[model samples]
Target chain A: MTWDILNIIGTIAFAISGAFIAREVNYDLLGGYVLGFTTAFGGGLVRNLLIEIPIELIWSQDYLFGIAFLGITIAFFMPDNWIGHLKKWVIFFDAIGLAAFAIQGADYAVSIQAPLIAVIVAAVMTGAGGGLIRDVFAGRKPMIFHSEIYALWAAFAGFMIGLDLMRGPYATLFLLIVIVIFRMISVHFKWNLPHKK
Target chain B: MTWDILNIIGTIAFAISGAFIAREVNYDLLGGYVLGFTTAFGGGLVRNLLIEIPIELIWSQDYLFGIAFLGITIAFFMPDNWIGHLKKWVIFFDAIGLAAFAIQGADYAVSIQAPLIAVIVAAVMTGAGGGLIRDVFAGRKPMIFHSEIYALWAAFAGFMIGLDLMRGPYATLFLLIVIVIFRMISVHFKWNLPHKK
Candidate 1:
């Protein structure tokens, strides 16, 4: 229930972000749809592959595809001013999507009895992989790799889940909320990972 | 077997291509190594995932990793003049690698009894997917999506194999040789897919 709702919201946010990014980068409509769909689904696709899930299961997620297409289409056709206001909140929406997906990804790994490291990898990859592909296809440096304390928050969520420091559906909900707030705060304060040069 | 030798040659060529591309784009040594390995392995990884191969099996290919590491390391450490000389033949090497991997990828799909479309997709992806990843990581346009008739040749080989217009190991070898020659000629003549500017 909670998980399903969060997943849909995250998918919508990611899809809209992908569409906007594609348009901003001057990609054609086909490019916009491809980027949008990939951004919405790439993470799950990667997670399923890592967990040895049947590939066909990914394509079978009709709701996921439907929501992504709807969101991206709306974003693609929306007027500039309408989008401009939303653009200010793009980072916020992206953070929400990331946090939601990250926790779910970790939970999936834990369900599969994956090791702690694998759980963390799943979390980070699921949270950020779509965005990475989105940026790469747009010819921009991936934000997860280049800036901000992003993947770390996903890792932290996964660690808490894997170590049994957190459990249960409500606990997962709490974790997701905390992660979203934490990500928003990180971006607001310009928190960043240390880097060379 | 003939296929085994061709795979090794293709791996080495792709790895070197990756290392050189990394250098050309001024990536660090670690980046060079990562890009190299990913370019050499990304397509196979994608293919294996589609075919539902165990993820651990990817790690178990000792010789494949060993060869990629050796080829990338050599390319990375080789002096500018040495690399420059090899760079001139990059297109030729890239075409050979593309043909070899395309046939091998199609063969794998056929072995799995994948549908004809899946076989063709496997062939083109296994041939061009690595280069796509390589270019994306290097922040350049993917050559497979543009320029000469690169992916078309890969698809041509896969189409023949999937339709059983070509059969057997010897026939596969013949297909590979013909595809390689065809790709080389296409490059020499600057053949391109029709596209809007």
Candidate 2:
């Protein structure tokens, strides 16, 4: 299914992003893999718990684990000089992963007949939980908490889904594109949430 | 029956430790409550998910939530001078909570007939997960990962329980006391894990 493809892509993208961050933070190779794996799967783990799904089911997804491992391995072996070039694309990939996971997370919550608030929370947590854990492991505040137009986009997607405004493959695809575009625009403009100075 | 009492004591102790950390880190009133609640309940949440327990069951424990909230509020209102004195006792309380949760967590895994590794993981995670999350939310490295004799005590309890070397109410109580004493001795001796400089 198209959803499965998107999920795989998101997993790989997030895994790579997590590995890159790990390297940037000077983590050892094992640390990089741990962070990468957590980034790719932590959200789903959280969503599964929230929806009362058996988390053992995640371990059955061999491809998910394989892809994350591959992504981290590749990131670890890449040339040092190429790191800067790759960094530019990390955000784009991260955004795609975020959008894909956000919609998918909402879908899971909806399937479970969770409340509206729970649906929105599932969306944001699924999209961002791995990254948040990654940052935590790296001893930094999660960037999404302070970043411009990050978690909000996921919340918006969840809102629309919970409101019954979006459904089906086409709607999901459309929303995904919109989220990616909006995230890029916000980043480009350096838009930020209000903070206490 | 005794386990329930120990559980309540552990929850209150962990919640207070969380609130104390939040105060030390200068979090707002709401942040203190959030951190306190997470520290008290996050371990159980992790344990439940891992053991395939329904997470909603946690909501049924109204008194647990009440205790955590009360602990945070009290910590928030403490006079500034008293804060330093309270910090000295936080570790002692934290060690008690750790032992209580570790035994409980291992017991849950044993009840479920989980593998030995899973039993050990459940024990350590249930004992340490909350504190790790507390540090993460406070934007610091988790102390257990870096500290000597912290996670080890939980692991020891788990190992003994899993190996059937310890059992029953009296055995659990004995292990708890031993863990606390060992932790305090390590702290007094300034024992720490070797780290790469």
Candidate 3:
């Protein structure tokens, strides 16, 4: 039940983010919908592909798709002033989405008995892959590659899960909180990975 | 035997094209190799995921990976003058790759009993998907969306194949030649789809 709720939150947050980007890029309604859907699900789609999950399985998540669609539609119709008011909240929601998706990805990998490295990769991919793809489609630089520290938190969660350091009912919730807090702190401090000169 | 040969030709051509783009973008050797490999295989990877092929099957194609690596290394080491001289030939090879991969993708979809629309999509995705991804990674608009009428040829091939209008021993060969010639002609004539203003 908790997993389902987290998934819904992540999907809605990503969809709104993607729709906002589409608006910024002057895309039409259809383009906005496409981008929104891709942003919500593209990460999981890529992860499933890597882990050998059937595409049919992904298609079965009709409720998630519906939620993403609703979020994008709402974002599309939102006025500029409303968007301005929500701008700060978007980041918080995005952090929540990131944490939830990252933990879910790690858990999935652990369930599949994937190696430690694979689990870390899966977490990063599931958490940030959608945004990476969304930026590519928008012809912008991928944020994860050059922005404030983000995917690292997902990798950290994956490492913890892979090592069996975090378990039990509250363990996931605790890790989610840690990742969300860390991501916000990094953003606030403008933390970034060192780039090669 | 024929399929294997076509696959090799396609892989080498794509790897060279990708490496050249990496050079144009001033990426390092590692980036060049990454782009080269992705350009050669990313389309098929996407197609496999869409069609529900297992990831293990893709990993089993070790020889194709080897060919792509070799091609990229050669491109990386080639003199700038040599690249300039070979620039004209790249398009021709790219057309061959597009035709071969498009046909291969359509064939795979048909084998899996996918619907006609799905088969057409598979063809276009396999033919143009890698280049689309490469352009995206390089932070450029996807060429297929705005460039000369390239993917249309792949779609044509798919339509023919899906409708079973082209079949028999020499059918694939015939379709391949037609797609290549049409692609070259389109490029030479600067044919393009009408875009929305």
- By DockQ, the best candidate is 2
Computed on C-alphas against the true complex, the DockQ of each candidate is 0.12, 0.15, 0.14
The window of 10 residues in a row where model 3 chain A has the poorest summed lDDT is A26-35
TM-score of chain A of each: 0.94, 0.95, 0.96
Q: Which one wins by DockQ: 2 or 3?
A: 2
Docking class of predicted structure 1 = incorrect
lDDT of 3: 0.84
**Model 3 CAPRI rating:** incorrect
Per-residue C-alpha lDDT of model 1 across residues A74-140, encoded as one tens digit per residue: 8877777788689757777777789888988898899889999989988888898888878887787
Q: Candidate 2: where are CA atoms >4 Å away?
A: A27-34, A49-59, A73-79, A193-197, B1-45, B54-124, B127-131, B137-139, B144-197
RMSD of 2: 6.4
Tens-digit lDDT track for model 3 on A71-115? Answer: 988898788778998877888888889999888888989998999
**Residue range B1-197, candidate 3, lDDT tens digits:** 88788888888999999999999889999989988988898888888878776657779989899989999999988999999888778888899999999999999888988767668768987988888788887767666655588878888988999998888649899999999999999899998654322
**What would the per-residue lDDT of candidate 1 be over residues B64-173, giving only the tens digit for each residue?**
99999998988988999997688757667777789999988888888877767568767877898788788888888566654677777888888999898888778877
Candidate 1 residue pairs in clash (backbone atoms < 3 Å): none
